[model samples]
Target: MAKHDLDPNYLDPNYEPVVNRSGNHPFHEVLAARLQRRSVMKGTVGAALASLMGVTLVGCSSDDDDDAADSADSSGGSASAATELGFKAIPVSTANQVVVPEGYSAVPFLPWGTPITGAYPEFQADASNTGAEQEQQVGMHHDGLHFFPIDQKAGGNSSTEGLLVMNHEYINQDALHPNGATAAADNLGVRPEDEVRKEIAAHGVSVVHIKQDSNGTWDLVFGSPFNRRITGGTEMDIRGPLRGYCKLVTRFSPSATETRGTLNNCSMGPTPWGTYLAAEENWHGYFANSEVNPPREQTRHGVGSSSRYDWELAAGGADAYVRFDVTPGLGDPDTDYRNEANTYGYMVEIDPFTPEAKPQKRTALGRFGHEGVIFAPAVEGKPVVCYSGDDSRFEYIYKFVSSQPYSAATAGGYLLDEGTLYVARFNDDGTGEWLSLSLEDDDFAAKVTAANGSMVGDINFTGFADQADVLLNTRLAADIAGATPMDRPEWGAVDPNTGEVYFTLTNNSQRTEGQTDAANPIAENRTGHIIRWSEAGGDHAATSFDWDIFVFAGEQGTETVVDGEAVVTLDDDNIFNSPDGLWFDYNGRLWIQTDGSDAAPYQNNMMLAANPVTREIKRFFVGPVGCEVTGVVTTPDVKTMFVNIQHPEVDWPFGTEGDHPRDATVIVTRDDGGVVGA
Candidate 1:
């Protein structure tokens, strides 16, 4: 199978999203004039305007290298007062267990396959869990998560006891199946139905009530009414524009207003009104279309010809596993699962406090492989703006600005339904614009590009007549809007003090030397970088803003320099790469987590803390081998922290080498019980 078949997002993100980079494209001259630049991309850094449209022709350069090097050495921590951090920075490690600063401690909790409620089934220690047993247990490969304070303390948001809600991005069957998975099930030439069932049950989100006692220790409260599991088979409501699209009609819900299950939930966000935004990334992996002519949408998103685990092969039995087959069979629309894939790829919201409430797919946020959603600080009557990233290479960054001013009394999900979705076009010259994807306001001119990618002329591509049309095909809408594609955008973090949005552009190995943008200045960008932007006039609803490279993540010895000066030098205090997950603690400290290669220069993935204002990054915690250092949440008091380790290659936290190492959340707290980072 082609690499794009495994994951469509793996393709080059540096590919110019607009058609004609060769300068001969018809839209080049006309559309260039149509793009109303809010600013001339003028900045002290250089003539960044040349690379603003992702194909800047000018040779832009910066001369702050010597000034930055004179400011701080890589061996030192941030130029800011990062030394005030409660603990010393820990070195990278490839150990079988998690590593924290000397003054901090890590306690593992809620490992996958562990029963959260119901009959209280023991995690089939012998790897003998049935499909039903797995359902009652915690899902696998934990990713983005949050802690909802159930009963809280006065004058604050921190709660000693709360509901812990998290997303299980994908399953790690090696630790799930007794002997692991195999594709060669010759029983009628299909994958074993039982194996497929176990995997399906292991995907989705988990909610459990947890308590931190007077001793500052934390543990799960099993059998609590609030403790529940949301699997890929769980029913969900398809809300907003994409809900009623004719293309979304499936056998499961002929009304096209509902869908079954949420899978590949990667990163997430906590709504101001207290709902969980569990984003579905890599959702296209679950579907396998066997149709001779797959829908263009499916083809664009990389829905495969066969299931990732061949779940479609069990079609002879029941529809339990049949939904994975999105192919348009001979059956009528009311009896086939053809449009099932359309139902996913949106942000699914769950109310942890109300376990009985149905999970909602907020389509107004638009769709793609949503790495996550991050809302700017809320103002009661101000328009609420939420930002999200399309996780594939060359995918655009997006935002949903509510059309109605936010009301504390209004529900978060409904506010999402009536909003304007916009795609970002970042100019190299510090300034960026948000292109409207709304049909009434969107730009539909498509600079025609041949199959070979040469620009032909300014041609009209896809057009929309309503909000649904614009949102249902969000990627196409952004493409028509001429949004600049980025390098695998992952999680985003908003500065509590400034409301600036920072997103991690996870490394893209596909970006070759020939493919380079001013912002994405590196080839094969093995070490990803963080990009930060401030909304115009401090308004999230604004269409344009200023942006710059916050910091280039790399190893200690690697000196990233430009214009006769050192841009960034990674050293012992902060040597990391591939920034993926990002969040801000109450004190205005930004925490960065990595999902980089786990090898020599990098023994393991790590989580780092940075002074966003000072651009100082400090290594805080490192995870066990084979695990991605992802998902983090801190108590308002900053006393207790929750960080997740996913898909560990070693049986860490559980025991020594032989024990089954399941992905789990680990609680980090100052041993002295002082405020974290105090």
Candidate 2:
């Protein structure tokens, strides 16, 4: 475990290594067909595609304050009404500060290392906090988050107070310590036990009770019962199909019903039953396999020979830290840590209001670098449905439909325990289908058996023996089923009004011209795009759907629909790349966040608002240099908005720009007290 032996790319949180070898139809080919079809259409490409997708297009306008106001046909009102952008658009900034539209205020709150429980230790600027202290403080690198109203049980949606829950994606190693992590004096391979513990403590979810004062300032309510930190060492329950599976047996959780901690948690989603869903993205990089050949579960998921942090090599050989190494021992699987890695890579459901509840890993959703899960609007007597995207190059998007119907009074995480997971297959035509990956799917079984001869190095590929196996090896199952390979699918949002599901395909630089398709049309796509699809008959449980390219990042995917027809709608007012985080406010205004490299014109990562009907985008806010603008949510009233600034390169929140940068949440509100995107 020498330093040089470490996987260099593993340390890069944004580096999604290309793991999908499915050879499935790439999205660019679909895009090519879509463009060709548009060429033959008489109307505008936007109008034609909108018609196919059951959407009505309006004249595109970049002005922030368009007076036309009507209800939208997708979910709520007439087809002509589109949500209007009320604020004046702002210019992109390279400054080490936040820039919002005029008449808006941005206040920083709940930064990393801010104590919320335990002894309530104060944050030291030198990063000298101990491992135990970090467990009681806010975690680092905030990502996906949500604000649950405080008085929901009383049937009240209070905007002044609530529980703010967020995911700490990963750590900024260089800034985590006074002088960074210390290696062993004798061997640079081993990390200090205390440092490793602190690092682990900083990688999970944080639930804090926050209150907004009359003056509009927000502060954390220290020592509240609802404030808790579920870190990498926290005990979590294993739920759903793989709960008692043999492959999950480890020295810690021998029953295979529980395991320790959640890692690499990225974006988050809310369950219909008032619970938070934390996505495990890039958790595979934290483990290493020394065996000559690893199981398909690890190999297919990109568990490399070397770990990202060398946690397995922590000093003193404590099982808590050493379990990161999945190398098989001389004893049976239960006697070693080979199955430890299998416990991760699933959507973990946590009840932020119930402090005593254990986080449940919902395995029925299928596991493969989940970016986040967005549930479709629940129907009283219909199946509960949700969608997730595997956040890696060439990976597939997935949909999970619960076997049981939904009921408000009895709904719980158990609803996620039994479901049929389907992988998306985008056809060259405008239509698409959800290919089932369940045990009852004969097509999946046949494909697995047919491809058995060509498959290599998968010791655990037993031809879809059971539902547990299919879920644990979800990427392989989707690959065999001929699912479409997307361009680094990341965060997703479900429009409450239209029932349209939107996903951000964060840039895929690995795509080639030969692999391009309609969903992913760009070759060497540096700036990614957003894709949206509407379920058939407006029913989320429907197997058939229609999809269209919502918008191309940096205007790259906008091909010529007809002669002299300009379909590229992005202008200087709202041009962004790497659209990573997406959310639709209750008003149906789509908020787009960027994690881009901040190329010219796009000075730094920012958040923009887009009108779904008009496809008009306007830059709303710009973040500091070297920071990713992610994890956005608003209070139930939509008057206040919270956005996370992760991994700032220089010192932030304190308004300095030299070093020891801290990730924090910024609160945005209109000075006149109006809706966020009114």
Candidate 3:
């Protein structure tokens, strides 16, 4: 569907401020003036502000050259016909049915119990899947994924052969066994290590190879050479600023030389260099506390009794169980893994090309519940910029500006090291400032030291040990630097052709009533909007930038009448709430995905596609009952698209009469058999 035509009344350029009865503050006044100016802009203010900031905003010129190079590398073939470019919606209901658009067919490749790595018994649907057994089997709840062609010479589109790297964000606890997870009480003080180990093993990432059959169906290559699993218990090396910092040390690895496993592998990104950047989200719920009080260091990190998870109370619990506990264990900080919490929350980079390579947790990018990382258009001799969001209430949006300029010779090399992290401060007046969270700044350190007293330093003191330390504890640094708190930032993408950055501000219910402000203008922002910003001078590394609300969420007609009279508003144009998953396809078409928990008015989550440059948007597909549409990736040809459906019907009562589990990945292709969004 096309966007609603803009009305003339809303286009008035000379409109003045309509004073509200509410009392004014200096912050509000500045914000009001900014919003007034933004209402008149046709495009982002980032480009114009770039000149003032003395940074260059990379634009269409660079992208044009990249596109030319990509074209030259491809075999000369006419673009796929429109009929071959269409997308078919698949209905994967809880009844275990996989539906596809007419004329297209689908086959289930790997189910929950399929064997991948060891000599394990074939999955028994009716039997309990042990933690150790689950480790040997395929992970549950497949989420974000990418299909990489094994041979680049064969073209990077979806082929009959290649390696598929998919993230199993989490497992469905209810579906873990024949019945459900065995409670500590039920187990009678005899917690099975295998059970806990199985759960941990299921929590990371899975890599497999698949081959398209002559009949056009896809199936897993059972024992493919590249197939591997990175679980929570696997050994991984520590990299970045905090690599060998005292806080990251533990009894298991006294020098902090290495750590065990990666968990909560959510949405991911693949660098040009072929490494995978997996984001860690919701990792706070894994630890627990003992009956007795723990050490001072644990409390220092906010790992107190109330902060612990239920799993900690289980039998056989100790340092292994307490490691998840943020509570400082007694004795030296290095004595236990209480400090281990500091290690997680950073982006873990894994070289899928080399399975033996230790995954590096790039600390240059500040840490938090990183939703995903999207790279800006790479420019020769210019620093590469990557955008990320802290996916939590009142968190901040961040960007990493690499210290080294882009060199084709090292395009896929180790450039993740040595970069500056900047958090966004979006102003109401369409302008924004990227505040640096640098260790060199004394003021920044003082603020952090005050909030987190464990940090030892003064206003004039640079307390950070190094860059890795800053990245590992990014949230602390961001708070000290006073970054703007956004609603809930998720996936972000940069328009290849226009160089505009689009990020999702997922809904925040706590923002109701008292939290209303100029930048966050609405109370109870249930339907989150998409925010776009251009770097000053078109450079991703600029300190200052300009931004604006590209879209606002709400019911289609609910916003048409503000104060009982019809007024032109953004809510009328492509109004959809809680924009979550986002990506830019090779064709430069912007795809917007939604994840709404509120069900009454909105039946289920959905996905939409838009042309940001033209403001043209359409509702492309809607998901089945109770699911979040996440982790979207498109082939280089833009002909095939893969979207993930995560935790469908998550709230259904456990063991209830009507409960049903929904989780799987479905392929969407056109009914006319054409490329998607052609």
Candidate 4:
């Protein structure tokens, strides 16, 4: 792939600046305000600096005064006793029951069938949940969440009273309704309107207020003022170079000023400015189409596949289901829903604090099967940086650094106005470069622009109009710009202590024996691995970076067996496979979550906590059968951690009575647990 030359003109001088809040409020005030009711004791300055930089840094303190208090504890006492917070594992059985350790318990902060809006009838287990009704109810399959403290004055880790934002990745049709999805019936040629509505409602995200009692049990405040559900039906603004672009125009919002809600919101991120970044993944399978009358710009955008679902053929399908087809039809681009596909894919930002605020689809981040977005710590007058991964075989990883410095004052609104988007190109020599994807660069244009002055060539540029268009169609832009293909890149995080960016390249089965190369050294990478790269000189905005494999997924010891026989083994560590969700806790502990492929000896999906610098990892907890451990977050105080357990053993012969399926969030904390990863 040819490297694109940087275009200085693409740099927007008039870009909005990031707001910084560090100086406006005292350090303690900022921490207290952000943490809310969470009890926060003063830690060493090193810990504060590490958290501020967005890197994982750990510090242990010894105080003789606490020894007397420690001896009275049930777990026994010693200097090392301070580090051992007795955490009990809760087993949430298929009965929709939440199990936890002896001293701890679990409750539904928000369940799967709660109502959200629009007079939707109460969710019925036996009756069909219409698409519209589904849209008005709580979405299914909750995953990856964070608790934002509602009260600015609340202190300590128990400041559990806050807004809980969770991702509703996708719905299980068989378990969602009394009967399976109407769209799945053999007699059902196309998806019904109700089914489409239900599917749409199941996408995107949910935010609700939650509080814990004096006993440390958590519960949701139903219909709280801050409780908001953002689904496929929500109104969202298109921001960045693609805003108002013709390619995005649709009949619903002819001007392209706004569009419907986000879809497939998987793992997510929380902004320093108090908003949530929900990622859209596995979006390609929603629409259905025929080659004969393909959308006018279908080929242009690389969505030439026949509809993945035949929703367009059902009653009221054209209006709801057909929009996903993306084939251009009669009527002006602004007057038809053909361009609806162009609206999705970007990272949608929502203010959990403001229920009525319009969600913004940040085109600057570039579009793909986004797994999650994580930020690097922001310094005064320094760029705010974030990293993302495209969760697909042979896709790519991306990073975005805001062009403007962050300020707490201006950070509240539209802080994502402008930024530099770069794609990672892992080299054979364990080095990587952040390839610029900005539209202003000549090299980018030369590669992206058609020879005849069209936005796309015979290859179909996907009918993009400008830079915003390019951003919305980021995958295509990256392809045209020659970004390196990767193996199923997933979640990523920037170490607040060391400034290193870590991402998961979850297995790529397409790689064959002879196709092995130094950059992607392993072929048939079933077990996957974690890759870490450091920006040049620890600078987030730098174009070049160094890279290395932090840990290879598989079992530990000599010739480890995968299933019944030995497939691969790790001499250094004993671990599980398919690393998925990842996050760095407040104390700089790297939490790694796993998914899929339970090799025979392996019991179940699990989560791990690691010391990144030492590359030492230990299994923290495992999930029940047929569940993936994903979307992990720790409260500001780090005493509590939340890990999402999604779709436990979803298979065939679905039923709602005895065989009904349930997905919920699990809160993990030590029985006598102090700060997590301590």
Report the number of the highest-TM-score candidate: 2
Q: List the residue pairs that clash in candidate 1.
A: 13-393, 13-394, 48-429, 50-56, 51-56, 52-427, 52-428, 65-565, 556-570
The TM-score between candidate 3 and the true structure equals 0.79
Q: Whole-model lDDT, candidate 3?
A: 0.59
lDDT of 1: 0.72
On a 0 to 100 scale, what is the lDDT of residue 24 in model 1? 22
What lDDT tens digits, residue by residue, belong to model 1 across residues 1-678? 222345444322222123222122121122233233311221111111111223212101112235333434432323344323545667778787889888888888899877887886888665678888888889888999998777532224755888889899886555667766655344546666777778788899999888877766677786799889899889999998777788789887888988888988889999988889999887777788977767656665767686566676763557877887887878787788888888888999998878889999999998788999999988989988899998876677999998788887764678887788888887635578998877566244322122213221232343454667667667766766777767688999998877889999876666565644443334566777777888899888999997766666665444533433333445667767778999988887889999877875667999988766445566888998888989999776777888998888878777523436789999888888876765
Q: What are the models' TM-scores?
A: 0.86, 0.93, 0.79, 0.78
Superposing all C-alpha atoms, what RMSD in Å does each candidate have to the true structure? 6.8, 3.7, 10.7, 13.0
- Candidate 3 per-residue lDDT, tens place, 228-322, comes to 77887777777656667787788777888677777666777777556678887655445444536543322222233432124454467754554
- Please list the C-alpha lDDT of all candidates, in the order they appear: 0.72, 0.82, 0.59, 0.61
lDDT of 2 by residue, 1-678 (tens): 324234456457877667776667777666666553333223111112222243433323464333223213332343223367777788888998999988998989989999999999887888889999999999999999999999975668999999999999998776887776665434655788888999999999999999988887889887689999999999999999999999999999889999999999999899988999999999998898988888888888888887778888898999999999999999988898999999999999999989999999999999899999999999999999999999998888999999999999899999999989999998867899999997677787777878775753344345766779889899998888889988789999998878899999887888677764443334577777788898999989989999887766663123323333443344468667889999998878899999987767678999999888767678899998899999999998899999999988898667533356899999999989988877
Which stretches of model 4 miss by more than 4 angstroms?
1-109, 115-133, 152-158, 184-190, 292-309, 442-465, 517-523, 558-573, 650-656
Where in model 1 is the C-alpha error above 4 Å? 1-84, 152-156, 182-184, 442-466, 516-522, 560-563, 656-659
Candidate 3: which stretches are off by over 4 Å?
1-33, 37-109, 153-158, 289-322, 411-413, 441-469, 517-522, 558-575, 650-662
